[model samples]
Target: MKYIVVKLGGSTLEQLPPTFYKNIVELHQSKEWSPIIVHGGGPLISSLLKSLQIETQFINGLRVTDQNVLDIVEMVLSGSVNKQIVRHLISAKGNAFGISGVDGGLLNSQPVEGAKELGFVGEVVDVNTDMIKEIIQKGYIPVISPIGIDENGQRYNINGDIAASAIASALGANLCLISDIPGIYIEKDNIKHTLKNITKAEVEAMIEDGQIFGGMIPKVKAAIDGLVHDVPEVSIINGLEVDSLIAYCNGEEIGTKIVLNKESSYVK
Candidate 1:
């Protein structure tokens, strides 16, 4: 069966309607394509940190996670946010299994390139697809939180988008990032135009030129990273659009498709 990894960003998850969960349930029951959900909880984490009088910092788009912050991250992402998504799926009449990367060694990770500056932040080195496959074989949608663990019993905060991309690449599945907007947009004169297709080089250039900033940097960077790891393609789609997931699966043009090569067809 074909697989699709759907990533829900924290900013957009609360605004998504019930229909979004219903569409996910439909996909689970359809047998045409199996869906795996990976989600983030940045806003919730930040809120909790604030309430606890903890200071949080971000370099680029990634959160700098020390041990204290990592604990809160785990408590929020794996504990509350993960269950919330599962509950929504269940309410939509779907069987959902929620897990974090730390569970069952699902995501074996290592410190990222800049470990000194970004404490406890990791990049996935390997994924345990066997557990994920078994979860899929049992006819349940797997909802994943991006908290990763290393060999030394150390936990790391994995970027949700990067985690989804890693899982998609490992499963040989397509990655779809759910965003508040339809796709990446650039302002020309007075009108903002959505990019139908983009390449890794173009994405980097856009970032360098300040066309893409803030949280978008990580999404596009994650897409490019997934492409580098052999994920067939990654699409950024708006979850607020009714049946947007279905539209993407139906081959309807609805979002930006990011590719590694310029020669690829972006129509689909």
Candidate 2:
């Protein structure tokens, strides 16, 4: 089965139009692709923590996740955010089922090396595809939360971008990173334009030159990683668009697609 692994950013998860979910149904009806979603919930988690009077902070764009923070992160990502995506799909006449990395050993991870200061945040060591495969085989889109587990059954928070990339690598699937932004942009002669295509080397240079910084640094890195690891394709697209998802699946040029080399890049 051809799989399209989508990573939905939390910034616009709740606000995605019904058309986006309708495109998901189109993928199912097309009989050529299976959609699996991996989602993040940063804004909602922060909102809930603030309302609950729990203090939290990020170190270099990575959330500091102590036990208190991990509890809230999981609750938001696995509960509210995951359900909202699944419900939205179903409401649009699509079938979706939500799961977390903690469920059925979907993601086994260990604490990120040299970043112990970040607390329970971990790097995904492996992705178990059995559960996700079964869900897709049954015709339900699997919505995943980036909450990982260790062999000892300890839960760790995984960066959604990294988790999505790792899962794509494990499955050798196409990855579409859905976010609030349409695509990466460059300024020339004071005109800013979104780049429809870019090469991995160009993106690396952009990151090194600090042209790419903050959270986008990680997403770009994840996209590049997916490409390097043999994922057929990877794109960072605007999730808020009415047809971005379908356009990507249909091979239309609409979002920022990352490529292994300039041979596949058509940056105009």
Candidate 3:
């Protein structure tokens, strides 16, 4: 079966716009392809930490996951956010199951000891695909949380983008990242949207030239990694659009498609 792995950003999750859910359901009923969802819960985790009076920090866009922050990350990402997405999918008639990187040793990781002060954040070293395959074989969409396990059986927090990219790469699936904006904009404030197909090198040059900066930097980097790792195509689409995901999956041009090399134009 043709497979696509989609990473829904935390901001998108918080919005939970009706149109987004409807499109997902519509695609779920299509039976043309299988989708595996990997989601992030950064905003929720931050809110929860504030409620608990825990200070939050970030180093190079990744949360500085000390033990306490790691606890909150697991709670929000694995417990609350994971279940919320699973419930939404099931309610929409999409067969969905919630899972984490730690379940069944799905993602084995090593501590990112580059900065010892960062505590329990991890980098994925291995991915066990058996459990994911089992769920796919059973006809259930696997909705994954980003928490991972370390060599010493310790749980560690992981960057959601990194986690999602790793899962897509391991599965050799087409990857899509759903965000609030319409892909990577050449100018964030400008109303004009450039939806042209682009290459990894072109994106890098844009970044170097300052056309792409700020929040888009990491996302484009993630897309580049996915393309380089053998996933044929990666896209960044507007999550708020009613049928953006379905349109992209059906080969209808609705988002910015990132590719490794320039090729003949073909949609659908």
Query: When superposed on Cα atoms, how far off is each prediction in RMSD?
Result: 2.2, 1.8, 3.4
Q: How does residue 181 of candidate 1 score in lDDT?
A: 97
**Per-residue error (Å), model 3, residue 242:** 1.0
Which candidate order results from sorting by TM-score in descending order?
A: 1, 2, 3
lDDT of 2 at 197: 84
Q: Write one digit per residue (lDDT tens) for candidate 1, span 157-256.
A: 9999999999999998999999999898877677778888888878888889898888888888999988988898799999999999999998998889
Error of 1 at 150 (Å): 1.0
- Model 1 alpha-carbon drift over 4 Å, by segment: 263-268
lDDT of each: 0.92, 0.87, 0.80
> What are the per-residue Cα lDDT tens digits for candidate 2 across 79-196?
9889988888888888899999999999999998646689999988889898888888888989999999999999999989999999999998999999888789887778777888
Q: Candidate 1 — which pairs collide?
A: none
Top-lDDT candidate index: 1
Candidate number that wins on TM-score, 1 or 2: 1
Q: How many backbone clashes does candidate 1 have?
A: 0
| Tens-digit lDDT track of model 3 for 1-268 | 6778889999888776767766666665667777888898888998999999999987656678887888889989999999999888877777888999999888898887554877888877777878888997887888999899976789988777777777788889888889887775554455555655777778878778877775467677777887777777888888888778878887888778888778523221
